[model samples]
Target: MIALHALQYSRATRILWLLADLGQPCTRIDYDRTDAFRAPEELSKVHPLGKSPVIEDNGEMIAESATILRYLVAKFDDDSHTPPRGTVDYWRHEALFDYVEASFAEVALRAIMPAFRGKPVPDDAKAALDIHLNYIAHALGDGPLLFGDTVTLADIQISYIIALLERVGLLAEHPTVAAYWAVLQEQPGYISATRTAGPMVPTA
Candidate 1:
């Protein structure tokens, strides 16, 4: 069994979704950012940052949401359905995944996050975010998924970020983003993770 350290409304949801996709049984310790449950000091035993989304498997600990997702996919490759790593689609997926992850981080910090938290974002930051959004929109190009037809790790990771942006109403006027978000929300693992997270709130 895997042990997952999770926090509500964090990237930890991505790890949970990946676990569900792999059909693995895991234990979760849910933490909240509120005063009552500060991140346990003991968590450094699991990760350097003492943060959520740390996973323990076979006496080994791993942190970082993207790393966890890749680990689960590689560890359970036989049983889990995943795209072939050697294929062209896989390369495309990887490219898009990196682009979106990097872009979203910038946009989140600059535009989406501030708006979601009811804080004001600078006009310059919003403009930068719009440029990134346009890039994502172009990359999408009417495809059901990021790379092509099949769902890849890229889809799972990027969709979660998109969902976060959606919660903040950042995609209100982006039809392509809305379409992508709709398809992702229909996935069982995505739905499970989202339900577990409860209502979305803006937090790091």
Candidate 2:
């Protein structure tokens, strides 16, 4: 069994979503930003950094949400359930996943983090956010999803990142992104994770 250290409104939501998508059963240890993730005695049992989204599988611990996703897909997914490898589509999928994970960091720093604190966004950060949004708009190009028409892991990952941006007022200018977000929200796994994660906090 896999044990997931989860937090509300954190990247742990992605892990939960992936598990739901794969129909895999796992245990969740919920934590909050204000709390110490692991008890003092259990500290060594979890990640050294005590971050959420750590997974313990067969006595091997894995941290980082993307790493967990890749591990789950590789270990538990059969051909019909896994993304294709060594192809154009596969590379495109990889690119989108990279973009979402990297781009959301900038978005969070620029928009969501400030909103969570109930503070005004810095002008410089807002400008940077505009550039980020434009990049996503260009990448999207009126597509139903991030990587063409299929609902790949790229779509799943990017959708949650964009949804977090939306909660921070960064999504209003990107109509294509908004449309893609709506479609992704309809996915069963996404819906399940959203319910568990709840709406994004206005601040970090």
Candidate 3:
């Protein structure tokens, strides 16, 4: 069985959600955050970066959210969670999947860092975040998911950042994206993952 090192308020839920959607069973090893809201040192024993969502499968350890997602889909999924390998939609899926953490989440986290430190978010940071949000709004258009009605790994990858934005009420300004998130929240896999591992935002 796969062993998942799940950290509280981390991207591990994305993995859990994917596993749920794939009907895969695994062992979940839980970790709590430090008082500073960082992953505990215990997590370092699992991975050098001490980041959450690390998985052990076939005696191989995997790190990074996008890498793990791709690994799981490639190994366990039967193309239900991804598009055909050589299609235009497949390229779009891969692009958005990578963009989630690299572009969107990076700016979203940057904008929220000051608030986490008990300080005000600077105007420049807020501007950057707004730009990203607008891009998402445009991408979303009038849809339920990032790429039509079917839920793909890209949508799963986007959920963590969506939860973060929702937690801070950033979605209030982006109604389309907010509506999209509402739809995602109702996904059975998301519900199961939340019940098993808790919400995606930190509590400490």
Candidate 4:
């Protein structure tokens, strides 16, 4: 069985959604993230970084949200959560997942960091975020999903960031993102991942 060590309200939620999309059975172990957003010390036992969203499959440990998502897809997706390999859509899936984290999420996070610190988002940061969001909005072009008609991990990956933006009130300014977020909400595990996963308790 897959063992997922999730940090509440973190990217681990993305893994939960990914697992659901893949139709995989896994145990979701939620952890209390500190007010500082750090995972509890116990997570260090699973991965040296002590990060949230670590996973173990058959004794092999995996950390990092995107890595865990891709690993699950490689091992268990079986054409369920993603398109078949070697197709345009499949390659698009790979690029979008990586881009969602490496590019788009980076900007979304910059915006989120200020909110997390209880500070006003600076105009410059907002501008930078706008540039990135516009890029994604354009990349989405005419979309329900990033590629093809069906939902895929790519959508799930990007949608997680979009949800973050929504929570922070940034999503309303972007029409494409709003539309995509609407479509993404209907997918399985979306509510659980984005809203229903709930908050972490203090790990005392």
Highest-TM-score candidate? 3
Q: What TM-score fits each model? A: 0.85, 0.83, 0.94, 0.86
Off by over 4 Å in 1: 35-46, 78-82, 197-204
TM-score of candidate 3 relative to the true fold: 0.94
> Using alpha carbons, what is the TM-score of model 2?
0.83
lDDT of 1 at 107: 65
Least well predicted 10-residue stretch by lDDT in candidate 4:
195-204
- Residues 15-99 of candidate 1: C-alpha lDDT, one tens digit per residue: 7777777678788887666554356566666667777788888999888777788788778864233456687756766777676
lDDT computed for candidate 1: 0.72
Candidate 1 positional error at 169, Å: 1.6
Worst 10 residues of 1 by lDDT: 76-85
Residue pairs of candidate 2 with colliding backbone atoms: 115-202, 116-202, 116-203, 117-203
Alpha carbon lDDT at 113, candidate 4: 74
**Model 4: how far is 86 from its true place, Å?**
3.2
Pairs of residues clashing in candidate 1:
none
lDDT of 4: 0.75
- The Cα error of candidate 4 at residue 124, in Å, is 2.3
Q: Write the residue-wise lDDT of candidate 4 on 140-179 in tens digits.
A: 7787767646777777677667777777778778988788
Q: Give the alpha carbon lDDT tens digit for every residue of 1-204 in model 2.
A: 898877656777787878888888788886655453233334345777656678989999898777788888889854432347787767866877777777657665667677645699888888887787777777766577665565666665666567777776777877777787788778788788767666433233
lDDT of 3 by residue, 118-140 (tens): 67878988899989888877877
- For each candidate in the order shown, give its overall lDDT on alpha carbons: 0.72, 0.71, 0.85, 0.75
